[model samples]
Target: MTARKKGPPTGGSGANAGAPDTLEGLFPRFPGTKDIRYHPVFQGGLSRWVWRYYTHRLTRAGRWFLGLTCLLGLVGSTSLEIQTYIPFLYAFAFWTVAGAAAAFSRPRVAFVARHADRVCAGETLPVEIEIEQRGRLGGADLNVLPSGLPIPVDAIPEGGVPVPPLRRGEKARVRLGLLCRRRGVYVLRGYRVETDFPLGLLNAYRVFGEERSLLVYPPFHRLARMEMPTGRRFHAGGVALASLLGDSFEFLGNREYREGDNVRDIDWRATARLDTPILREYREEFFLRVAVVLDTHVPRGGRRDEREARRAALERAISVCAGITDYIARQEYIVDLFAAGPNLYHLTAGRSLAYLDQILDILACVEENPDEPFAVIEPQIDERLAQINSVVCVFLDWDETRRAFVENLRRGGAGVKVVLVRDAPPTLDPSGDERAGAIPVIGRADFERGVEEL
Candidate 1:
C-alpha cells in the first residue's frame, strides 16, 4: 500500500498555495485535469461534437486498431489485395462507433476522500475513497486512474484501484495507502476517475474533484528520562538565578515576609531580633524556566555533498529541539524557544501539551536562513537568559564561535547546557570531561545517550 506523493514534493509552494500561516486553497492541477484551452473546436479545425468525441473517445485499443487498419490498407493498395484491406477497415469502423457511444455513456458517480485525522512525516495513512452512483447508473465497471498529488499516493495491489459494481445510489470504498514523505498541511486536489464500461476498447474518464487536506506534524521520538541542571545560586540585577525555594540548605538571605510567602520560611529567630516578620530566602528555587535556543542558519558556500550534509544536519537539529522541547515541557518547566531565520520563532510553553504542540507546529516549517547567523540572535538569547535560570542551546556547529557563546552564558549567571550537532561522531572522553563545562557534542546515533547523561 502506498499513497501518491503527498503533495508537490518538489517545493512547498504548490500552485495556489497560500501563506504559510494559513494553508488554504485548492491544490495544483496535473495533466489530465487541465481543461482544453484551445482544441480543434476553438480554432475551427473541427466541430465541437468531433472535438468532444476526440477528447475521451479514443482508447489505446481503439487507436491501435485504427493504426493497424491504415497499415493494412496501405499494404493492400501496394499489392492490390482487397481481402486484407476490407477486413481491417470493417474492424476499425466497428470500434469507431463503439468508442463514440462509450464517450457519451460515462458512468455517473460521486466520490469522497477520507483519511486519518492527523499524520506525521514517515507515517503511512490510508485514504479511503468512497465512490457512489449519482443517478440510476448501475453495475458499471470503471478503470479509475489516479494522478499523483505532491506526495506519493499508492493504490493497493497495484494496477488501478478497482471499484465494485454497486446498485443505484450505492457506494463502494477503495483504499489507497499514502505515505507522508514530509511535514506540512497538504491539500490533495483531485483524482481522475476513468471508466471504459461494457467494452475495454474506449476511453471515458471524468475529473472527480476531491479537495481534501491533511496535516503532518513534525516527527516525534520518545526519549529516556532526563534531568536538566538549574545553575548555581546567583542573585543580581532583576534576574533571579534558580527558583524562589530551591534547596533548603542553600539559603541566600532573610527578607521581610510578604503575602503568599511560605509559612515554613518564617524565621522566628530573625523575627524576634529584628522586631519584624523575616522570611528566609533561598537561591535556585523557582519555576524551572529553560531557554531553548536553536541554531537554524544553514552554513553556506561548500561542496554540493557538504551542503546537503549540512542541510540534513540542520533538520536533525530541529528534530532534536522538538524532542528536547517536549521533554523539558513534560517536566513542568517553562520552555522558551528562541530561533531566528526567515522568521524569529519564539514561544514560551508551559507544562501543557498544547504549548508543546505550538512549538512543534513552528518547528515543522522552520527552515534555515542563509542570511542570518547565530551572532544576529545572540543579543536576543542574552536578553532571554537574563530572565531565566537555565539556558539550553542547540547549535548547528561547534567552533570558537559557539565556545564563546557558552562562555558568555556562563558569565550571565544562568546555568548553561549546550548541545552541539555535527556530522562526525564526537571524539572526547565518554566521561564527558574532555570538553570542560556541560557542552555535549551529541552525535546523531547517540542523541538519546548524550542528552540523558547531560
Candidate 2:
C-alpha cells in the first residue's frame, strides 16, 4: 500500500483561489477508485449498499429493464398521456416479476475447488470445482464464477463456466480460468453459483465459503549473460549445508589412522599394504556467494501520474532482480537476496540449497516503501559481509543515499556492481569518479524490447 502524506491540504492556484469547496474538489481525478472503495464512509452504510446492489444483485438484463422503466415513467409523467403510461406499466410489471423469481431462485449446493498453490502473474490459473446438488429439486443452467479475486471483474471471461444439468443428489465438475494481472498473495473465498434460468433477466447466486490461498510470482525476462566482480568464500559445511551426507566432502589423501578417527573413514586396502590403519583426509569447500540488494523505496507526495511512473520503475527493478537471481543460480553460486519494503526480506538460496522459486516468492510480495529502505538493508548486509563474495545492487534511482550505500560496501572489501532501473536514460553519471566503474541503467523501452544481457 502507498503511504499517504500527513498534513493539511494545499490550496489551489490564484485562478481558482475563490472556488467553492465541493465533493469534486475533495476527490481529485485518479486512474482507479481504490482509495474511494476503501474509504471509511464508503465501506458501510448507504453508499456501500448501493454499490453492492448495482454490481452483485442486479444482472445486465435487469439493469436494462430498470433503466427503460425509469425513462418511460419520466416521459409519461411529463406528457400526461395514457398511451405513454402503457409502456411504462408494462416495463414495471416485467421488472417486478423478474425480481420475485430471483428472490426465490437461490440454489442449494456445495462446492469443492482444486487449483495449484502458486502461479506466475499474467498467466491464467485453471480451477476445477466439484458442485454437488443438495436440494430435492434438480438444477439446470448453473453458472460457476470465482469470487474475491484481487483483479477486476473484466479479467474473467464474459460468461462464467457453464455447469451441466444435475439431478437430485447428483454432482458435476466445472473448470474456470482466472487471469491474474499482478503479483501478490490472494485468498480465494469460494465460488458463486448462479442462474438466469427462466427469464434471463435477474441473477440469483449462492456464495460458498471454501477459502484457499495462492501465491503469484512476478514474471521476468531470461538473461543470456551477466557479468559481475566476484570471488570465492569458504563454506564450512559445503554441500553438507544442503544435504547431510553423500559427495559433500572432497578427497585429499590418505593418512595414518588416528585413535579418534571414525571407522567409516578407514582405508582398508592402504591399511593392509602398509600394515597400519589409514584414514581419508578431506578439505572444506569454497564457492562464490553473491548478494542481490533490491531498492523498494519510492518517495511519496507526487501527482498521480508521477506516482504511477515510479511504481512502474519499481516493478522493472523487481524483474531485473529476478533475472539476476536466475543467472546466478545457473552459475552454481550461492545467492543471498535482501529487500526492504514494509518489512525486511532476506533469503539465501542457490548452490543446490534452494531453488529460484523461493526468491521469486519474495519479489512477488514486496511492496513500495515510502521510507528509506537502505537503512533497513545496510545492517543486514553488514552482518553477513564477511561471507558475501560480491554485492549487486538494483536501484530505482541513483541518489546519494544509494550511492553511499554501494560505496560503503565496496570500501568494506566486497566486490560491488550497480544496476539502475529508470524510465529514461540518465543525463549524467551519479558517480563522478570513472575509476569506480560505470553503472548500467536499464530503461523502460529496453525492458519492452527485451533485456538479453546485463
lDDT of each: 0.62, 0.74
Question: For model 1, what is the alpha-carbon lDDT of residue 71?
Answer: 89
What residue runs in model 2 are displaced by over 4 Å at the alpha carbon? 1-44, 75-93, 152-155, 238-240, 243-248, 272-276, 302-304, 425-432
Q: Write the per-residue lDDT of candidate 1 for residues 1-454, one digit (tens) a residue.
A: 1112233333232111222222221122112222232221233435534444443455657667667877877776776545776776787687777767676767678877777746666777777788887756574666564443443232333335778877888888777666665665555656666666656667677777666655566565655665555853343423232323233246899899999999998999999999999999876445567888888767679787876667677766777787888888777676788777666667777645246667766676566777645676677777767667788888776666666777788788777777777765444432354433656566667653444544
Cα deviation of 94 in candidate 1 (Å)?
5.9
Against the hidden true structure, what lDDT does model 2 obtain?
A: 0.74
Clash-forming residue pairs, model 2: none
- Model 1, CA-based lDDT: 0.62
TM-score of model 1 relative to the true fold?
0.66
TM-score of each: 0.66, 0.83
Report the Cα lDDT for residue 167, model 2. Answer: 84
**Which consecutive 10 residues in model 1 have the weakest lDDT in total?**
21-30
- Residue 2 error for model 2, in Å? 23
Runs of candidate 1 with Cα error greater than 4 angstroms are: 1-95, 143-148, 151-160, 201-203, 210-213, 232-285, 353-355, 425-438, 442-454
Report the lDDT tens digits of candidate 2 across residue range 1-454: 1122232112211011222223342322211112224233345578766655665567778778778888889888987745788899898888788888887777878888898977777788887789898878778778887654433111246357888988878999878877766666665656678888667777788877676666777778989988888877676764437732233467899999888889998999999999999998987667788999999887789787877788888888888999999999887787889988876789888876777888887787677899989888899899989888999999888766777898899887789988889875443465674645777788888888888888
